[model samples]
Target: MSGSGIGHDQWKTRFGFMLAAMGSAVGLGNIWRFSYVAGESGGATFLLIYLFFVLIIGIPLLLTEFSIGKAGQMDAVGSFKRLAPNTKWHLTGLMGVIGGILILSFYSVVSGWTLFYLYQYVTGAYWTEPDGGFGAAFEAWTSNPVAPLFWQALFLGLTILIVMRGIKKGIEKANNLLMPALAILLIFMAVYGLTLDGASEGLAFLFTPDWSMLTEPSVYFMALGQAFFSLSIGICGMLTYSSYLKAKDRLPAATVGIGLMDTVFALIAGVMIFTAVFSYGVEPDSGPPLVFIILPSIFEGMPAGHIVGIVFFVLLTMAAFSSALSLLELPVAYVHRTLGLTRKAATLIMGSIIFVLGIAASLGFGVWSHIQINGNNILDMMDNITANVILPLGGLLMAIFVGWYLNRNQAINNSEIESPILQKVWYNIVRFLVPVVMIVILFISLFDI
Candidate 1:
């Protein structure tokens, strides 16, 4: 494989790179997962804490990843090897690659569900409302071993096709198309939700913070985890994406833009979901089933709800697709560069293997439901392992490497922050605060304390 230089694929424009990076950050986490977690954690208070973490922790780590990628100018693993030659820092990159693969395995299963929901809407099948309620319908459909697997395969196939086309033509182009569409869809839905009868209640629930919850330790823990996960920093997806960027790219501006857009998308998604939930008299803290069961049921009862249902699912599928592309691209970049394989060959090989792994995740909701790891079903087991364990560990190691090992001046220069004050602030956070908080998160996730 070639080293970081003119040999690497470069982003065509700064805007394109921003969109692609934002696409990675604003996935199902923003909409599906963000909504439920926010609801469960105490809507307004949780959001406040989440934003705090994003500002202090998320942006610093994001800049760290960007700096690493730009300086190394190679795939995730190659970048580490290039930067810290003869050191084991590359193992962190390897861990990130593994985390990406594991995350996408179960992530694809959920994205497949989004596609299936989209198909149901487009075909007008959702209007019929089966014998059991939407809750029962979702349970039955997900539990059907064959059906979920088919959708999962289809979703993974789409991701593979995009990655195989290479960066400028495949990944960048797809994000350029999908990210704007997702934004428009989200804004439109949020506006529509405002017209509902329960808009007031939904708004209050999402924006009015309860100071009491601020003292809760679990709230802070969940917020920190969400900030890391939502920013897509820990898995080296940002590092891999930034590897394609030119030296002139402004890392700070891109970091802020991506982080702000991601947070706003989550808030808007909360508004859209909670408004519909309240308007339809459904519970706000409905957990994971909030999107699959609660929202669909709400859509069925609203006027012109079928059209809204189509739009909602279409938005969801786009968000999931954009994120999945980045996840798959992480491993694809590593394999293509390290193994000396063509992008097409690498994508196909990695994509096929991930698909096979996702089949087990899909079965977990059905036939494999009986199987549990630490009380989590198959899919949940994968999610917990990656999100809780692998991702936090990876992020922690990255902070340590950047803060303690990387050349301080070179790291600051790579960050592209002009203000000396801000530079010191960022360096210290990544060096000190970030590692401590990440350790706490890792410990909590491991022991479930």
Candidate 2:
């Protein structure tokens, strides 16, 4: 294949396509961020409002992305340029592609954390650990740069391998197995966690509103931001996945499937974490270290800590890989389409370059720990741009493009996506409610509200 462009393959089935899309959207963000934000908000109250924004803002925008991708059968670059006729819409694709680059750099670092745990598990490390070792271990891992970088490259390379296998054998095959397996593992973990003695306190903490926490105006805005971020909105992942969609698939239904799945997983993580922490009479809001610090302690004294530890980390690694592969792919596909590079060439070349870049992100953990412009490290910087800037803007643009630029009926029903009353609801949100909410979110985010 040399420098030649890669071949594009259609999804094997509509179901496979749905799994791939959902797999990307329903990864770490949903599992970790959503419930925490929900807890910070008025819990059930925020959940209701979030449901509104998700269906309206998340689903409609998602449909728009997919519709654009399938309509042009093009990557982000070609899709917009084709639609707007010399307008700047096409450049948004470049923005999305670059955002992927920025995200993957730091993203892999965290994924590396999962990998390190996996290694520890196989070695029976967690099984032999002291009660408080989990926190110290996590500290040792992050406080040093070397370990983060090594595992980050390992994670990124794994992601590239799956993508380079092409869509059918790679994305579709892997997600079909991985997503359901992930769900199953989480459920088992949740059940096991429920049995733990300390799990109830965490549950109470998670479900309790603490309405006093609602005083900050930023809380609501942050809730909306979390909902978007957790669902992988505004990243063009939705758009890119839709690019592979067949016309026969109902765009609305597919989006609903993906959105609901994303929401479900987040809530499940909440329950899983809640049961474990509360059972042990431990508080859950321990922050950042919640996953690394809390879960390992909970599992260590369990009957099969080594087995569960291995399973947990393996599942997390796979989840990270699924999302990262899709992230890397957005740009690789663009490179192939716009620059005419082959899939293998794109994967290997881009993969290698990103692999090296991953080192900088990995180093941010320890040796390069001193590097910071505004007290933000590489991962923090990348997350800020993608979540606060690039993503919201993309979502905002999609709402405008779908609601204003194109004929309403044609733009929406054009995909022939099913879902009756809900579609109308999404239409209304896209037209009025979501835009207003998102505009407020954009403004609030600008000032760090």
Candidate 3:
């Protein structure tokens, strides 16, 4: 294959495609956000609801994206334009392209934090901090305007270098190495963390249900949002990735496999995080800093502490890297295909724009601290806009377009599933359940309605 060509690539194999999709789905959100959301939403109850959303909503949307991409044989925006020509359905793809860009803006900021912490762990910087000092250290780091921007630029530079190499060489090869290493490291960390004295308490906190908490409407909305966002469904990168798939690949099986693996990774991360929470008596729902702040404090008290810290932070960076690559690729794919730019040129352009946006997010913690949209600073505002509004809006459009706009027989035929009964069930979920649930959550989240 020619290195810079736009429309001339296929994944090397089915395994490669699935692993790439899974890598995109499983990221920093799985560890930091999922664990906190699960804890705040009532643990086992939240898990059950999240799994329901994953199966009923996530899997079908995954298949929908794969089917559209494979049949259309184009990038996310081009796929819609190809599939339903002369219609507004392509706007769904546009939302995804823009959404991916918005997501990366702030995502890189957090990824920068992970990169900085990885540096600290590797250099034994954490060793010098006083006991129970990670929270202060993290605050100090974020509140420093120049340092976070430096890290964000460094992280975005790494992401751009990988993506500039073209799809098969850049995306597929990176995921092939990184995803397996991530899975193995997560399992090891989970098992080791469980050896702590308060493991039982952690287990109970995760598995034991507080049924009364289910009455809170916020938990339902939270679980549903996590279900959609955690799988990387609404962001449009999945469609771009699957656009590289060959027709021989089974969409149904691939979708389910990716969803299951992503969910399992999040669960395992919860094990690692919550065990440390209970052992160290750290607050479980301490929000976004649980992994960066609390986990480091927990590690400080463990034997072979620095080694464990290095492994954990490295795993976190890998997770962030995998997802950020996909985010960067979404716009790159669009620009390369739609605007006639070379893949490398598109990648560099999009990466640079996202890096510039990330500087604002980085400064939101320090220089721009006084500015707020509804009391959220720049980073949190970017996160809120993308996660709360754009994602669900994109997802809502995707469900409707796949469920209602596209021809049913074509969708079924394109999906390449073997079972007739399963096809009917998938169609119903996409058409009805997914749209209703997505709109409800989107309204509640965006408007507090």
By TM-score, the best candidate is: 1
lDDT, candidate 3, 219-276, per-residue tens = 7777777877789987678988888877667687888899999999988888778878
Score candidate 2 by TM-score against the native.
Answer: 0.91
lDDT of 1 by residue, 1-449 (tens): 14554347888999999999999999999888888889889999999989988988888889988888888898889999988999999998999999899889989999999999999999998866777888899999999979888999999999999988988999899999998899898888989999999999999988899999987777877787677788998889999999998777778988899999998888888888988888888777878768999888888888999999999999999999999999999998998877888889999999988988988988887888889866678877787677656776777788888899987997788788899999999999999999887777656645655
**Candidate 2: minimum summed lDDT over ten consecutive residues — where?**
1-10
Q: What is the C-alpha RMSD of each candidate to the true structure, in Å?
A: 1.8, 3.4, 2.3
How much lDDT does each candidate structure score?
0.87, 0.73, 0.83
TM for every model, in the order presented, reads: 0.96, 0.91, 0.95
Q: Give the poorly placed runs of model 2, Cα more than 4 Å off.
A: 1-7, 35-52, 130-132, 373-375, 418-423, 445-448
How does model 2 fare in lDDT? 0.73
Best-to-worst ranking by TM-score:
1, 3, 2
**Would you list the rank order by lDDT, best first?**
1, 3, 2
After superposition, the stretches of candidate 1 with alpha carbons farther than 4 Å from their true spots are 1-7, 441-448
